[model samples]
Target: MHAIDVNELYHILYTKLGPRHWWPARSTEELLCGMILIQNTNYKNVDRSLANLDAATNFGLAALLALPDGQLQALIRPSGFYKNKARYLRAVLQAYHDHYHELAALPTPSLRKRLRDLPGVGNETADVMLLYVFMRPAFVADSYSRRLFARLGQDAPYPQLQAHIAPTMRLNIAQAQEFHALLDDYGKLGPDVFGLADQYQLKL
Candidate 1:
């Protein structure tokens, strides 16, 4: 798809969905924690897990760091992949505790690299943390984003797609975060807003 068309799609989606208020978190640390827990999981489940923790404890970095692994696993069970996700979370938290000593002191690039280096944290997860928590300019590409782009006839693979789009968007960190939130909201609300499936016919 042409860059103009991509931008048009973004505009249409944004107009339809408005602001998504995504990556819902009570604090920066919670946002980062949610990003790690949310891999391979739905937002609803992640919310449930976060609420579970919030209701029972302080839900701060210190509390999370002090919590036993088994307890953390149990609290986040709703997000699924509890055991592996818990291990990944612990590794990330430990890295923060050891190096930064406080979440605010963690440099964005350094924290992002460290997160990407940890097991179970990939580009998407790392970018989520960077964008939502660190307020960095990082675009996230996932399955729904790929499907949307493919439908619009862009042929790049996921990684290349991100690289191709990020520069073209010309958005700063805050704008990138808003752009991603808008795209995700579109995927969730597309059928209802477009009504294209029933209005048009496709050979494929």
Candidate 2:
């Protein structure tokens, strides 16, 4: 297990991926909802779900809470795990209503903690909400991140990858945001840009 030079990887991937413009949310609420819905599914599925929801109504706190569970489940079906994702969405909306009385009123840390405590939420999902929706400094890790680091020969586990990359991201919130976007973009481009065959000795 060898350590990877993330700074070098960052530069290489950035040059390959260019500007990512990640998270792809139109609003704070949409971004937060997308973060939850995106789990275990591709962005295309997530977009389909969002489009379905958006076509029917505004997808606001009140609108979503007002919708029937079955209807909501149907709308977000594209994201897969419909019933479970619906339940998770309902719980998060309820938490917003119950605790802060409104989405705008919720404090970043408190909201993040509450969301993280929910059944389906995990570090990656929570960090997405924190970073994209709340504009916080949280780092997000996904399979792409893990694969990229592993292909670079960093033998550390996924959890440890965050610590390794965070410090090198310049300690500025904006830089962290860009760094994440770049990594995500690099991931979206797949292994081709990272010299996957040369690095891992595998054929594409």
After TM-score superposition, the amount by which residue 178's alpha carbon in candidate 1 deviates from its true location, in angstroms, is 1.5
Q: lDDT tens string, model 1, 18-130? A: 76676656776677668777788778898898887786666777888888889989999999999998888878767666665454467765766776887878988877767
Cα RMSD to native, each candidate?
4.7, 4.9
- For candidate 2, the lDDT comes to 0.69
Candidate 1's C-alpha runs over 4 A off are 1-9, 100-112, 190-204
Each candidate structure's count of clashing pairs: 0, 0
Q: What is the lDDT of residue 174 in candidate 2?
A: 66
Of the candidates shown, which would achieve the greatest TM-score relative to the real structure?
Answer: 1
Cα miss at 33, model 2 (Å)? 2.1
The positional error of residue 135 in candidate 2, measured at the CA in angstroms, is 1.2
> In lDDT terms, how accurate is model 1?
0.71
Overall lDDT per candidate, in order of appearance: 0.71, 0.69
